[model samples]
Target chain A: MKAAVIVFPGSNCDRDLAVALEKSSGKAPIMLWHRETEVPQDLDLIAVPGGFSYGDYLRSGAMAAHSPVMREVKRMAEKGVRVLGVCNGFQILTEAGLLPGALMRNRDLKFICRDVHLKVENTDTAFTGPYTKGQVVRFPVAHHDGNFFADDELLKRIEGNGQVAFRYAAADGTVSDATNINGSRNNIAGIVNEKGTVLGMMPHPERLIEPKLGGADGKPMFDALVEALS
Target chain B: MKAKVHVTLKNGVLDPQGKAIQHALGSLGFSGVDDVRQGKYIELDLAETDAAKAREAVERMCKELLANTVIENYAISIEG
Candidate 1:
């Protein structure tokens, strides 16, 4: 798959995401700077990596969402290109109106950095096709403003449309408040847009694509994109 | 022209930081504090001179950047 990783100032995970994409697709993805207004038309995926973009000045990802490159990213997504945003990337997507809901301050007001379990809620979408529905996977979440918030009406709509892709869960795949690591509404860890072309999640999947990094649970997500897009 | 903007979390949204502050105040022996809601106060110096036009411009700024309308509400006041 022809993919590109968008790099903004303070984006620490840009290289890590590029490496993961390269390993899965067998080709190094193009690195696009945040100032660029255009992206290669042949690209199939655009990955927005994690970290405090724009120094998290006003709000996490708020400034980066308005970066020039995002206009092209939005245009590309409209033409059916897949977009995957992880961690701070997720915050940017939501701020950019590419996804629903807002990521707020953690309920406990602490920066949580640890491996947590997630339950795959959908397997039919390109982002999660390689994993079975209800499968449990472990991924590391590192963030302070990862609490997801949505009003009742919007939450019900996304839930009814199956936009939810993954939820915080236990080892046996049970989802509950106790398993919710960030106080995300409905334990949401990831969600897709209405067309399922855009995905934004708070976990750092690229951080654990290989066993040497601790686990390979995140590999299937990349592999799924390669298999489906190719 | 000077524009003062106050961005506050919308009602019905949980304010964890405000709650933390409230708790801290309670522990410090302060009483009768029903609630504590945290918000951002931003002061901007604008080149626009007319108060009406300044208010209008600052409103746009608040809508576009100063406040996220999804979870926050903003109020703008202009002073010369």
Candidate 2:
């Protein structure tokens, strides 16, 4: 799979995401800067990595979302190119209108950095095809504005369409209040679009692809994308 | 002419910074603080004179830089 990782001014995780994609797909992905108005032709996947893009000024992901490259990203997503946005990338996707809902500040008014347990709510999407429904996975979340909010009707629409891909869960794969990091409504941790081609998640899966770092659960997500596209 | 654009999170959206300010005020013995919502005010000095053009410019600035419309809304007012 020919993938491209979008890089903005403050994108700190571009290398991490690139390494993860290279290892999983056995092909080094292209690194595209935010100022470029075009994506690589015939690209199968585009990954937007996490970071304090544009110094998080005005709002997190606000400035980066308006970057010239996002116009191409939006165009590709509409054409069914697979897109995965992690952490600040998620915030960017929402700001760009490629996804619904907004990521707000944590309810506790503090930055949360910890390993959070998540439930695989739907494994049928292009991003989660390697996981099983109800499976538990651990991914690290480090952010200040990770609280996800949407209107009641939109939430129901997303849930009813089985677009919710992951939810916070207890160690035994049970939904619980203790695992609800950032107090996101209904413990939402990740979601995919109705077409299953675009995904946005809060956790840093790119940081956990190796066992030496901590866990290898994130490998399957990248692997699944490669397999489905290649 | 100058225009000021005020961007604020919509009502019912969680305002952590505002909450922190409210708590700080309470700790400092300030009472009657019913609520607090943090926002941004951006002043733009434009060369355009037409009110509609100025308003349009400010609106574009808000959408393109001053605010994230997904979570926040903005209002623009022109000043002499």
What TM-score fits each model?
A: 0.98, 0.96
Off by over 4 Å in 1: none
Q: Highest TM-score among the candidates is held by which one?
A: 1
Q: Which tens-of-lDDT digit does each residue in A27-140 have in candidate 1? A: 999999999997899999999999999999998989999999999998998888999999999999999889999999998899999999999997768998888889999999
C-alpha positional error of residue A7 in candidate 1 after TM-score superposition, expressed in Å: 0.8
DockQ (Cα-based) per candidate?
0.80, 0.71
**lDDT: worst 10-residue window of model 2 chain A:** A174-183
Off by over 4 Å in 2: none
DockQ computed for model 1 against the true two-chain complex using alpha carbons: 0.80
Query: How do the residues A103-221 of candidate 2 rate in per-residue lDDT, one tens digit apiece?
Result: 98888878888898899998988789899999999999999988888878889998999988999888898886677878788899888888888999999889999999899989999
